[model samples]
Target chain A: MSFTTPTIDWAAFAPIIIVLGAGAAGILVEAFVKTPATRRTVQLALSLAALVASLGVIIAQWAALDGAGTVVMSGMATVDRQALAWMAILLVFGLLSMLLFASRDGGGAFTELGATAPGSVEEKLARRAGLQLTEVYPLALFAVGGMMLFTCVTDLVFLFVALEVFSLPLYLLVALARRRRYLSHEAALKYFILGAFSSAIYLFGVALVYGATTVTDVNMIGTAIVNLADADPLLLAGAVMIIVGFMFKIGAVPFHSWVPDAYQGAPTAVTAFMGAATKAAATAALVRVMFVAFAPLEWELSWLVWAVAIASMVYGTVVALVQTDIKRMLAYSGVAHAGFILVAFAGLEGEALTALPFYLLAYGLATIGAFAVVSQVRERAEDGGVGAEAVRLGQWAGLGKRSPLLAGSMALFLLSFAGIPMTAGFIGKFEAFSAAIAGGAWPLVLIAVLASAVAAFFYVRLIVLMFFTDAPEGAEETIAIEDGALTRVVIYVTAAAVLVLGILPSGVLNLFADASVLLVSVGG
Target chain B: MNPMNYVILAAILFSIGAAAVLLRRNAIVAFMGVELMLNAANLALVAFSRIHGELDGQIMAFFVMVVAAAEVVVGLAIIIAVFRARQTISLDEPAELKG
Candidate 1:
């Protein structure tokens, strides 16, 4: 017998490895060289550096991506343009989160809260009174690194491990806010327990999958299933188990109850991370599993996804309408968006998978920015209330008069959510819908459109409040722009990109097409 | 030892461990269950390698063991911190998250 060792591609793994390495180093720096100022700076600087390094690597990968991704390191991972796109989006979200969380509690434009708020002496004084969320950068970055690794993982073992790495950090971040420990802690514990349960279920599913195929490599499983093309109960069981795990993680319908609670109870910055990056990773990994390994079983998983997607859409929209709290409404709105993303999944057999990447980018940016605005508006602890109570749509009354920039930004995102022409959100949904329609999924498209219309009501409701209502006496409290320059930069860029993509969507459409072409999933 | 017998025993143990991880709420028990599951997998992988006269499965098993150790260590620390702060290991009691 002869044995040959498969070469590992350390270079291909560089982008993710860098982030993980930084996370470890940042903890070490804080542990040994500990001072409050140093603690903040070390965590903040390390996080920014890690993401920046990942971005630089992403640029290099993009430049070289003409037939670029090769299965590296004995086929442990496949580095492709899609992975690059997902990582890029995650990194960008991390950067934006850092910026949005930039300010400290002292009176500054980028305050931890109401720093740049409107109103006279009273509102400013009130802004000064709100509770502060400190050292959010390290936690946010830790989660980002987890997400970036999740996108690049090629095999199932690596996939599950990476998922937990990203997920655990976020569970902790939710509880770590200096103020409002009770709300935040409770949220964290709930998220941790359930998230861990979901992960264990996911891992067991992976185990079953390994048992069925007698193989752990994902692409190899794809090869095995296609080669056999028969009803191996074990294999089917494995596939079913794996699909259930993925389904739960993405918060599709039955598994979605955890989402709103986690989103509403978590500190806003943590909420932003979970809303944007975690969902992106979980969805991206799902596409990798179903579309990549189980493409042969499309006959099976497709219908299941369709049912979940439809339920998610209708449930999300209906529940969102009656919610009085702004964050809760957005939480339901998120559930609806999850349905839209899955609608793209329902067409997994063809050009529809292309929409997955672009749709995630669009949805993530808009959602992150929306949450950022929410974080900024909620009142501080010193303001003599629990963590910010500013969610009522009417509370946004007269926002246009006071903090025009914040209101305008919120309006832009809301319109994008409404899929108004010319914003990235519209382009994203349009592309996904077009692909679904191309796949001859008329009913799904029609339902998706109707749900979009229903969902639009609440998104526009906030707009009317922002533009019409007189800023409730306290509504003029401007959101302190956090000092993290990157968060604001990301928000501005995404908000602007929303408009730009809306205008010349063809460029993005072309990118989506080319990117979609490379997906080795069911259709392409 | 018969390699096939080892494989079957490992599979049984793996299932038992997975069930424990799923059905139990005590953090330490869950951690022990995870450890059991990983060790069972390692045993199976090693047994298969001995039967097939291969090294790949053995190496993979070794890696799994290493990761299991790391996971148990970190996971236990986090659970401990949570328990210390809240003074309870009953996982069902932390249900304040509903909006």
Candidate 2:
């Protein structure tokens, strides 16, 4: 018997290939490069180059493929404007985060020797010698590749593979922080156990969905459901399980127990990257599954989405009010932002399609910038070696007087998080609420507005503490600035983008609107 | 016996695995629960493939095994590291990162 081979389009798959290749090359560099210093430089350069190269390729492919919606490997993967837009957004964030990752003179944010016990003589010696773990570069690249693939895959099995690809690296990265090693390790354990559990549930859901429909391709399943006279309860059960998996990734309430711990425990650079990129990637998949594959069941499933949105908003906002730690507070704020974005998801219509990507972009920039500022504000020790970040809310009082630029930037990001009028968060909230309103989700929008007002109190409280309060005695220079050009670039660029995207939103809004057309079927 | 029996068996196994994960305190045992859950999904896939007269489900089962193996490597590495540091494999002991 003659075998017919399925034709593969390499050009359509270039961005994923380049990023994964860079990750592999980084591993090789670690093995071959004798000097740790050289390996560190090489890995950082390689990661940045990979991200930039992928961005360039995405732009090149955008014009001819814009709105074309081509399915590359039969039904395995689809390349469309929606996937392309998300890919571009993820790559930009990845590049900025790498700069944050590699921005320090004394071996940066990661532990010099990750396997060494924290506070041991070996660890102290490694720190004094300024050893570095260049492996984080490759791990991050793999995560980026997985996230990019996650946004575009049409097959359920491929989606699971992509989910694991990104998650495993992030679990390891969360454990690599230089200080608070126990906390980091604990967070890593919790994240891994829960994350794997979620994936298993997701896979079980996949099996049942496949069993009910006898198909693995999302579009095929959608088609089968459309043809069936009565919808199977098994299909609905599978859908809810899949939604839970996505919610876990996005850090929505009930499934969000890991968010604050992981955020507080990880190196700030890693937190910046994962917070923004994971939300974008998971939201992309959620939208694809809901709008493209499960559209017919919108009425039955919309209530589930609404309950999650409201729960996340109310819980995140109320809990954040009492958090003394800035990272934990930001983590809760992330939960609330996830809820706001879920407002768009609950709409599950053409209007939501327009609002979701723009909201992710605005939210991502503010988050990365805020975390970059956090990374710089460290506690000054007697030995002149940088201590861990002073994250307690009390430590931040009178920060405005100490460093006007950093504190001002932090305030800008916080305002954006609060949905202030001149920040991107405002536009994001406005678009999301309007979309929900148009989709007849007015009550959800009203609750969201009330939640936002409640959330504003904490953000303003922090701002007040910074600018109005006096520095608690002799704590003037305790908040040491780790001054790095790369970190500053990350802060300035995101802060500027937040303001620009807020005021002159038309340009980016039109771009998002153009890329909002999702292809449900192969080559639609 | 009917092929549907295998599917029912798989479902029972999956529920037991889920219960173990929720109820168990030991990190390794909880991890084992995840493995059991994955294996149940594999069993279901194989049974369903037979009923459907296709190789797709069998192929997916193989993929699941490879992914599961990789997961064990990472999971064990993490558990061992935590155990070494704290001298306990119990997840309940590490209450350092709450709320």
Candidate 3:
């Protein structure tokens, strides 16, 4: 028998190739470059260039993808408006977060000597000599590349691969904090174990689906469901398991045990990047799986989605109300935001699709901005050196008196998180609720509204603590500010974007509406 | 000899792995639990491929193996880091950041 190779479309695959290729080259730089300072500069420059270049390609392809979509690489990936929108968001988030990573207040966010024990002489010596783990740049690029692929893959196999590719880097990055190595390492271990466990279940689900449907391609799975005479129990079980995997990534209830710890332990920069980008990537993939591959089973899956959404909202809000650590609070708040995005899935139509990407963009911008503010506020060491981030809510007392600009930005982000009027979060909530209502899911929206109200209390509490409260008596630990141009740019851009998107959402709303359609088939 | 039996055995192995992950206190053993689960998935894939009369499932099993291998590399590095820091591989030791 003669075999013919399938024709490949390299142009459709350029964005992923460029990002991953740059990541591999970055690894080479880490090995060959002698000086840590020069290696960091090279890595930072290459990473920014790669992300910006990918964004350029995505924009150039955006207008061309008007109708159904292009299926490339023998049906492994689909290049369409939905994928393009997520790619743009991920690339933008990557570029902005790279700024946060490269920003240095001497120690920056990453450990100087990751392999050395936390308080050992070798660690201190390495710190004194000013060593930096420039390897983080390549890991971030790898994660970004995986996220881009996660949103666009057309097959379950590719889905699993993308899921792991993104996850492994994050697992490593979570452990690289310059301070609090113990907590960081522990968090990484928990995240790795739990993440791997969830993915295995997802793979098993894929096996069951293949057994029931006789196909591995997601589009074919959808077709198989319609072509089959009856819905197999195995098929439903498989779907739920696959969704369990996605929920773990999204940080929904029951699967959200990892979020708070990981968020609290990871360096602020990594948390900011992962919080904004990972949720977007997972939500994009979830929408494709639910809308494109499992559209026919909407009636069966609706209740599961609603249950997870409601539980996530309630649990996230209630738990966040009691959190003392700012990062942990933000992590719980992120859980609630994930629920809000999932609520749109209650409406399994184009409207929900339109709402999610827009909501992700709005939420992502505010999150990255808030974390940038978190990174700026440092603990003052005895020798006048800058320590780890000041994470305790009490530590933020009277911050407005010292750094009004930083306090104001954090307050703005909190307002956005609360979905208050005149912020991007408000617009995000409006579209999500409206879409759910249109789908006849008003009860879920009502529950969501109540959770948002409860969530608003916690966010407002932080705001009040920052602006209104006096520094407690003998609270000698002052909040030290590290001036970095990179972080300053991130803060200003995010703050301004939040206000602009809040004020004029029509332009982006229309884009999301137009790009909501999924091109889901084996053929282009 | 039947493929259905092999699928059942894989399911049992997967359950054990899940139990180990949930109940084990040792980080290394917990990690081994995850590895077991991945291998179980590979087993199911091969069994399913045999019944379906196609090689796609077998190919998927290969991919799973490679992924599992990579995961082991990363997982071990993390476990080693944790062990060096605390002088223990027990999951219960690190209790600094908890609600």
Best by DockQ: 3
lDDT of 3 at A365: 96
Q: RMSD, model 2, all Cα superposed? A: 1.4
Q: What TM-score does each model's chain B reach against the true chain B?
A: 0.87, 0.96, 0.95
Ranking by DockQ: 3, 2, 1
Better of 2 and 3 by DockQ: 3
Worst-scoring 10-residue span by lDDT in model 2 chain A: A515-524
* Runs in model 2 lying further than 4 Å from the true structure: A105-107, A522-524
- Candidate 3 regions exceeding 4 Å error are A474-477
lDDT per residue (tens digit) for residues A224-310 in model 1? 788775867756766876776666667778778878877776767667777888778887777777777887888777787788889
| Candidate 3, RMSD to the unseen true structure | 1.2
DockQ of structure 3:
0.82
For candidate 3, give the lDDT: 0.90
DockQ of every predicted complex: 0.20, 0.73, 0.82
Cα error, candidate 1, residue A219 (Å) = 1.5
Binned by DockQ into CAPRI classes (incorrect, acceptable, medium, high), candidate 2 is: medium
lDDT of 2 at A217: 87
Docking class of 1: incorrect
lDDT, candidate 3, A1-524, per-residue tens: 69988777778888999999999999999989989899999999999999999999888888666575677775588888888888988998999999999999637889997898899999999989989999999999999999999999989988999999999999999999989888899889888888999999999999888888878788888998998788778889988899889988999998999999999999899999999999999998998889877888888999889999999999999999999999999999999988998899997488988899989999999999999999988888878888888899999998888788988988999999899988999999999999999999999999999999999999999989988998887674566877778898999899988888899989988888878888876642
Instruction: Please give the clash total of every predicted structure, in order.
Output: 23, 0, 0
Name the regions of candidate 1 deviating beyond 4 angstroms. A1-6, A105-142, A348-350, A380-389, A392-394, A471-490, A518-524, B1-95
List clashing residue pairs in candidate 2: none
